[model samples]
Target: MIGAGAAGLATAIFTGRSSPHLKVLLLDGARRPGAKILISGGGRCNVTNSSVSERDFWGGRSTIVRHVLSGLPVAETVAFFGEVGVPLHEEPGGKLFPDSNRARDVLEALLREVERVHAHLLTAHRVVGISGARGGFTVDTLQGSIAARAVVLAAGGQSLPRTGSDGAGVQLAQRLGHTIVETTPALAPLRIGRADGSFHERLSGVAHDADLTVWADRQVLIRLRGSLLWTHFGVSGPLALNASRHWARAALEGRAPRMTVSFCPGLRFDDADARLVAAARERPRAAAPTVLAAWLPASVAAALASEIGLPDVALAQVPRDDRRRLSHALVEWPLAVEDTRGYNYAEATAGGVTLGEIDPSTMESRVCPGLFLVGEVLDVDGRIGGYNFQWAWASARAAARGLATTL
Candidate 1:
């Protein structure tokens, strides 16, 4: 094992338990294991999803994800964690977290499992190079060189460099004749450039529930509905984070994707227009912002009203053109995203080693015998929530089973 993260630790635990006669060694560059796990889910590790499917992942082939997930489904993951003494509880959107609500608890459970299986864990051992053939392999680390019959690369992706995943695995795979897909930051905040009289600058720190859509070359790529947060430089939150992958990919291809957010996701354009008109009649003396505040946040309503030049105008005194403009702004507010916050702020990486080069059932490399690629090192990334962690668990299990067979 070339990492000691969620995937690498799981692989070491399973491989050690399943094949006790064979020794399993887990190496990490960091001083401690599961550095990313400690910070995940706002310090409450989202261990897995209550429900999981290949559709939840982006990049690579869905069939590959399906095969790996089938080997260790979500239910099995839950049961496995329970056996490890980390009982899980489900939250909204089927996200499962340790009942203790501390990421340290999850990591502690994994470390306990590793110790139980008698797996050797070496921290501060960075793999500098790997050279091997079919029968034997030599892994060169900063500490020293170790020989093994098989090797599993679970070093993860380029996201969260502070956690030790700094794209070294991708470079290693490339040297061993594997194709690496162009990687980009996914599940990160989208940066909004200064537009003429930018409302985002004035509305920084505001959050609201909205429907977000991604458009590339006038074509709608995807739609997400969730909380949208405005920052001084960009937009973030569930909706923006979910849509970041599509936007980043489009930008990488030289296509500028536009993000359109609808403040009232449940209301149609005509319905919103009618509602504004009805509110004007019902609260004739009220300002337009006040009427909008009934459904939206007061700050948001004020910002939108100010954007349309009707910040303090009475609802009844508003012109028909201004009413239509306000309705349109609420329904289809578009923002030209400058770029994402990049890998430093990204939760996961979108691309990795191409799925076609690996056997889906075992996660073994077709290009190199006895070499397995698992977790975020492969071209598999899931949405926010517990899906990515579930991928880590499922892929690790699949790789462990395959490693056992080789042993």
Candidate 2:
């Protein structure tokens, strides 16, 4: 194992336990293992999801993902973690976290399993290169070089560089004759270009449930519904993070993607228009901002009302055309996204080693025999909540099974 992250650690645990006669060595550049796990889910460590499927991921051979995941499904992951002493509890959206509500506990459980199998864990041993092929492989590290029959590359992606995934694995794979997909920051907060007078500047720190959609070249790319948070830069929160992938990819391709927030999610234009008309009729004395406040946050209502030029006017006093305009603005508030926060703040990277080079059933490299690639090191990223971690678990298990069989 060339990394000790979620995938690497799991691979070590499974490989060691399954093939006790074989020697297993897990190496990491970090001083401690599971650095990402320690900070995941705000320290709660979302280990897996209650329901996982190939559709949840982006940028990979979907067939390979499906094959690997089916081999070790989410149910099996839940049971495996439980058996390892990390009881799980499910939250909204099928997200599963440790019952203890501490990421340390989850890390400890994985470490315990690694110890149980007597796998050699060498922290601070950064792998510089790998030479040789198939049955005889030499892994070069800062400390020294070690020989191995097989090598597993789970060094992860460039999303959280501080967490020890600094694109080293991608570089290593590239050196070994693998095609790497262009990587970009995904699940990161977007940076909206400031208008002369941007409402987001004043609305910073405001959060509310909203529907977000990405549009590029006049075509809708994706739609998501979740909490949308306004920051001084642009937008953050679940909805914005989920939609960032589309926007980032489009931006990278030189196609500027426009993001529109629908404050009144699930409401048709006619329905939203009707609601405004009814509000005008029922609460004739109510101010437009006040009427909007009934459905939206006070800051959001004020911002929308100001943007629509009806900040203080009475609801009934507004003309029919202005009412229609207000309805449109309320439902489809346009935002100018300049760029993303980049990989430093991204939750996961959007691209990695292309999946075509790896065998779906075993996660072994077709280009380099005896070499396996798993986790975010491959072009497999999942949406927020616990899907990415589930990928880590499933892919690691698949690679372990393959390694055991080959041995």
Output the number of the TM-score-best candidate.
Answer: 2
How do the residues 130-238 of candidate 1 rate in per-residue lDDT, one tens digit apiece? 8996559999999899998899999999888988999999988988899999999999998988772578878888999999989988888898898999888879987
| Model 2 misplacement above 4 A | none
Note the Cα lDDT for every prediction shown: 0.89, 0.89
Clashes of 1: 0
Task: Give me candidate 1's TM-score against the actual structure.
Answer: 0.96
Shift in Å, residue 38, candidate 1: 0.4
TM-score of each: 0.96, 0.97
lDDT by residue (tens digit), candidate 2, 246-314: 998887787768888899998877999999999999999998889989899999888888877873679
